[model samples]
Target: MIIQRLDELAEVIEVPLATLNQHYLDTNFKLKVPVHFARQIEKGNLNDPLLRQILPSIDEAKSVKGFSQDPVGDLNANPIDSLLHKYQGRALLITSPQCDIHCRYCFRRHFPYEQAKKRHWQTALEHLASDNSIHEIILSGGDPLTLSETGLLELLRQLEQIPHIETLRIHSRTPVVAPERALKLDWLAALKASRFNVVLVVHCNHPNELSDETKTLFEQYRRADVTLLNQSVLLKGINDSAPILKALSKKLFSQGILPYYCHLLDRVEGASHFEVDDTPAWQIFETLRKELPGYLVPKLVREIAGEPYKTPIIKTL
Candidate 1:
């Protein structure tokens, strides 16, 4: 998927293919992008915010100081093969590592999918059944929505049996990149019909990522009894501006999705290019708050090495 884009981007932008040599451009993890997302990139523009995300570049292969394989300590927190209990009330399940689009800055890009493989889909379910303390299960990775309706529905049904799991939080970029997946599944309708509190935590970094198509997608999901929230990573050249963040929040609210977290990019080994400094990130959020209602301002936070929860970048005035 990425190989084709590398070539396409090189051709369109007239940047010599040699500039993005295969040795350096091809990160260990392969790029995965759907055609819908590819259309969003501005042809001949290499600096397109959307393009910078999925397009592999020589920079990704460079190692920088402080970046590591397991940035968030995912390996240390795992109690089972596919489950991670980092926070007190929630448990995240790596349902599948198959994502429709591969963002270059993904923190989990270097995640050892093979080591954490689940023998049976029921493996995580059985573990959840035993832990009554866990009240929520976050379905992540590649993207849970990528699963077949039958597979997804079946997983949700099993989760239903785990009485303690009161909330189902799905973290995916599908709503932005592949709104059709959400439209196809009737996600909000199907999940809301179940017993759990369905929360779709979508990933949208720029306001531009939200379009008329995605807006309608959110409306359809909102029509159902599901909660919609958005989380964005503060990227260097993409959304480092206060105006961008404010616009993103407003756009999200218009679509019935609240601005949730504006994360300082994780210090993943290959994604150092996206990092925004803590001071600037804090200032950006502060400026953003003055222009918008408090509710619309997303909390600016970072995931430090061993923190149980996200560390807020600044103390709000």
Candidate 2:
């Protein structure tokens, strides 16, 4: 689908071409919009929250003072080329550089993905085996679920053999963006069959993303041995409102998915527009706290450039 540009999307839905911003569409970053995820957009409605996250806007073309290319310091933490070992006891692996949908605000939009792709995983696995301190492995990237089934299984099987590695965390947008992938993934049970506890972290910004099919997918996970969790980026003009966040939490709870981190947008170059200032961001979280139980309220935090863990924002004031 060439629906990457607002004008292109306008053509598809018969919306006004003049309304689209062409300057930002020229951004060098890759643009991908999967058919399943694109269907969630309201016709002719450019301000649709889902669309806002994926659409390129003029704001993205500006340079915000604090924003930089490697905002989260992925390069600094790259011990082995494909692996990121920022925090102790856990590590993140770039399983692949492919994703089903290209979220405009992705912090890694400007990351040196080519460098990450060139290095194979065997060396990273060896580094893991050498360190008894690290126990959990996080599969991340454009989305690890994008990896071939045979490759994913091989990786999981290898991780399980490492004596100290007790957990395998797979973070992917696949299940939420296209729930059928979750249904068709036959390797989950087998992966769980290994000693490591398997967890799937899904990215969802709105309740609308959790369609009937998505909810059913969650139901399947609940019945299985795998644990399901959701992490939503606190995007401005998206789920910034308290009511929207609360509704998302309630919906997630009802579907057997736990609300995990509600991370403030990383100060990355192009995604500065999505960064909600501290005051309003916390105010929304505070209001959200009043409306939902503690468990349902995800920890609101910021990923400081070189921090070992996500620094939680304990108070709004």
Candidate 3:
């Protein structure tokens, strides 16, 4: 079940109706919390890390400098309505226009889903086939896993015909936020038999997001030879602390996932409230490096418009 109303969420988490109403903001990017995720929040605790990431607040209405609707230049990189080829050798397809949850800090919260054209399916496929330089195709969106079994399998079938494509990468939060819906036997079976190397990069912020269901799902994917990895955003008052991030990494590894990228929050207009400043962001990463093995440390990076790759935040003297 999905919770889209403040009153419904308040009832589940035991937060007072009056108190919840004070901070809630009914914006275009409205509330969309999966029941599986919502149950993990600490009842009556408004400051829960998981809750903070999803709950819309009045703070989103603030106008902050250096923030815009298209923070990562997604629109500029979009050659076609359905495809985005930002980084070389890889292309991202908006496989689905919706997600199970609406994270407050999502950089794509303001994305123009209405603009996604049905005709672009063939256009995207033709473009990918013609570009021998592009070896990997990334399935992203709201969440590609949200697509129906038949729809997803059919899309995969088409991509398999592209002789040059060697890898299939899917970036989705579903495996973490809504494991029940994401774990499909048919999809797993298809991925196992696919010629391309399959990597499923799941989005997870806090350690609390990792649960028994996620563990079971990750194991299933692993058995299918799917490389399981996680990426997190460094958000203010969320998973910004060294201790919290450290815990997250340890927990992820325990469940057969690797820490991939710990991104500095994109300066999307409404998500400015979640941004952690450069000084503290670097400091947190430096501390994290000291506490964990090198491989366990996620690369601290930021996405800059027009940059060839994600720029790493190198600590300075």
Query: lDDT per model, in order?
Result: 0.80, 0.82, 0.93
Tens digits of lDDT, candidate 3, 182-291: 88999999999999899999999999998999999999999999998899999999988999999999999999999999999999988888989888999988898888
Candidate 1, poorest ten consecutive residues by summed lDDT: 1-10
Tens digit of lDDT per residue, candidate 2, span 62-169?
Answer: 888999998888889989889999999999999898777788899998877787782568898998999999989999997887777787888878888899999889
TM-scores of the candidates are: 0.92, 0.94, 0.98
Task: Report RMSD (Å) for each prediction in the order shown.
Answer: 2.5, 2.0, 0.9
lDDT of 1 by residue, 1-317 (tens): 22345566566545566664543365567656666666666765667788778777678877899998888899888888788889988999988777888888888888877765546457778888998999999998778887777778778888899989899999989889878776755445577688888889999998878888888888777777779999999999998998888888998999899999988888988889888887777788778878898999988888986787899886544
lDDT for 91 in candidate 2 is 90
When 1 and 2 are scored with TM-score, the better candidate is 2
Q: Once superposed on the true structure, which residue ranges of model 2 sit more than 4 Å away at CA?
A: 1-8, 11-14, 21-24
- Which prediction has more favorable TM-score, 1 or 3? 3
As a TM-score, model 2 comes out at 0.94
lDDT for residue 54 in candidate 1, whole number 0-100: 79
TM-score of 3: 0.98
If ranked by TM-score, best first, what sequence of candidates would result?
A: 3, 2, 1
What would you estimate as the lDDT of candidate 3?
0.93
Q: Among these predicted structures, which one has the highest TM-score? A: 3
